[model samples]
Target: MARTSNMLKAAMALVLCYPLAIAESEDDFWEYDVRVSEGYCVYRNKTFAAYVDYTLEEPCEKWNCYPDDQMVLEQHCPPPPGYEIPSNASKDAWPYCCSNSTSS
Candidate 1:
């Protein structure tokens, strides 16, 4: 026997290449950052948390050494129905709302 026919052709080439190497493609590779809880803030992964909550000229930017045990993240304003609150608001406005782009 040729070594059991070359070990059955190397086990049929590892069972036909094992499903193309386990068909992978979870965005191939990626990793933004930013993630919080309680008050909220997710960014990178995007969805909610007011997209990085309040800020003061950049309240801790990403990849910018931001993380003093977490800061800014207590957004809460007169926002409810369809949202609103942006009359030249500053002073690190919380829950910056603006629903339908029809500024009133």
Candidate 2:
């Protein structure tokens, strides 16, 4: 009887923890890709110089090209609740352009 109770408790613990594990994994938003050689990275037929960081306005993403030929892409998430972009703010600018607003 004690063994059965322990097994049930363990099963319940795992069930409660599973969703937390999945959520944690979802927090990893960066996507990685490898290039054929140790040089520049290309996207949409455009070549990005090696060992530099670039931002795209259309998709609101920041990507980096490493000398080792690895590209890391990070897509910026939308502004959180209560966040707003001032009319004067440059939408073309990433991250820095978002600000918290009290009005809504």
| Winning candidate number (TM-score) | 2
Q: For residues 4-92, could you state the per-residue lDDT of candidate 1 as single tens digits?
A: 66445533543353333223333211223456565454554433443222322232121111122232222222233333334665534
Clash pairs detected, candidate 2: none
Model 2 misses residue 96 by how many Å? 5.1
Instruction: After superposing candidate 1 on the true structure, give the runs of residues whose Cα lies further than 4 Å from its correct spot.
Output: 1-32, 42-48, 51-53, 58-85, 91-104
Superposition error at 8 for model 2 (Å): 42
The prediction achieving the highest lDDT against the true structure is 2
Models 1 onward score TM values of: 0.19, 0.42
The TM-score that candidate 1 achieves is 0.19
Q: What is the lDDT, from 0 to 100, of the residue 8 in candidate 2?
A: 55
Report lDDT (Cα) of residue 54, candidate 2.
61
**Residues 28-83, candidate 2, lDDT per residue (tens digit)?**
23545646243677655556775344655545554445434254444354432333
Off by over 4 Å in 2: 1-28, 36-38, 78-91, 96-104
